[model samples]
Target: MVTDQAGHPLFTTSRDRVHAEGLWHETFHCFVVNREQRIVLLQERATGKKDFPNCLDITAAGHLLAGETVADGVRELEEELGLVRTLDQLEHVGVFLEELTLPGFVDRERTQVFLTESNQAISDYHLQATEVKRLVAFSFDAFATLGDETTTEVVSIEGERFGRNRFVPHPPEYWAMVERSIGQSSM
Candidate 1:
C-alpha cells in the first residue's frame, strides 16, 4: 500500500493502486468548550444533503484534502467559521476513525480532533452555506444525558422518528483526549 508523507494509507486496487482513488480526505472537528465548561456548541447539518443529513453534531467539522497538513486547522477555522486562529489557539487533542454507511457509499474517515476555550459565541460566525446550515449550543452535562434509548426523544436529529436508538455521533476517543489534556494542565 502506498502512503503519504505522514504515513497515512493511500488509495489502492487489486493489481495497481490508484493513488488518487484513496487519497483519504481528512476532516477537522473542534469542540469549543466554554469558560465555565458548561456549554458546548453543536451544529445541525442542513436537511439537503447526500450524507449525514440533518444530524445534530459537533460544532464545526470539515475534510482536509490531499496535500493538506493537520496544521491546516487554522485555515479551516477561518474558512468554516470566519474566525482567525493561531496554532496555539487550538489544542490538537487526538485522531480517530469515524465510519458511516450511507446509501450508496461508505465514509471511513480519519478525523483529527481539536479543542479550544473561548468566550466567543458562534453567533459572530459567518458559516459556509454549502456545508453548514444552523448552530445550536447546549449544556455539556445535559448533552451527556442525551442519546438515552430508554428516554423518549422529542426531536430526532440523526434518527428517524420511530427509531429507538438515539445516535450520539462522534468517536468517544476524541473526547477522552480532551479530558487527558485537561488533566495535564492541572498537574
Candidate 2:
C-alpha cells in the first residue's frame, strides 16, 4: 500500500514496486523481551536475504498487507519464530515513520511497534530457516548505547563481537523511540 507523507492511504501497489519506488507502507515490529532479565530479543536475518542479510534485527517484523489491520501483524511471530501470540498479549508501542535506502531498494515505512514479555530461552525458539538464522539475547542497556554513533565499544552477540555497524543502521531517532517505549513498558 502507498500513502502520502502523513500516511493517509493513497493507493495500493505491489510490494516490490513499493520498495523500488520508496513508497510509504505500513509495517509491524514486535520486540520480544525478557523483562525480568532486562534482555531483548534479536533475530539474525537469513544469510540469503536480499537486504541486510545476517544482520540482527527486531525479533519479528513484516510489512502489513493491504486490508490487514495492525493486529494481523502478529502472524509474523508465528511465521518467523514459531511463537503464537495475540494482540491482547502485546503492548502496543507508538507508531514511527522510518526510511532506509539501500543500493537497489528503498524502504519508507509507517511502522507500528509492539512489545511482549517472554522468558523463553534463545535456544528454544523454532526458527523459520528461510527467514531467521538465529535468535540471541542482548542487554537492553547495551543495545541502547549503540544509538550513540560515537561509541567505539564492541559487545558480543551470540558468538560474534559486534560494534554498532554490525547491526542494521536504523536512524538514531528510531532507536530513541524504541528506548523510550521499552523504558515506559518496564515502569
Q: Score candidate 2 by lDDT.
A: 0.84
Error of 1 at 110 (Å): 1.6
For model 2, residues 75-186, the per-residue Cα lDDT tens digits are 9999999899999999988888899998879999999999998998887888999999998777888768766777555364444567676688788787777777888895
Poorest stretch of ten by lDDT in candidate 2: 151-160
Give each model's whole-structure lDDT: 0.57, 0.84
The numbered model that scores best in TM-score is 2
TM-score of 2: 0.92
Hey, what RMSD does candidate 1 come out at? 5.9
lDDT of 1 by residue, 1-187 (tens): 3335354757533211222233334667776667464565666666675456767666677666456666775676677567677767787776766555544554555677777666676678777776667666655544444544344442323332422132334454544555455444321
Q: For model 2, what is the error of residue 90's alpha carbon versus the real structure, in angstroms, after optimal superposition?
A: 0.9
Prediction 1 global C-alpha lDDT? 0.57
CA RMSD (A), model 2: 1.7
Model 1 per-residue lDDT at 3:
38
Location of the lowest summed lDDT over 10 successive residues in candidate 1? 12-21
- The regions of model 2 sitting more than 4 angstroms off are 152-154, 157-159
Clash count, predicted structure 1: 2
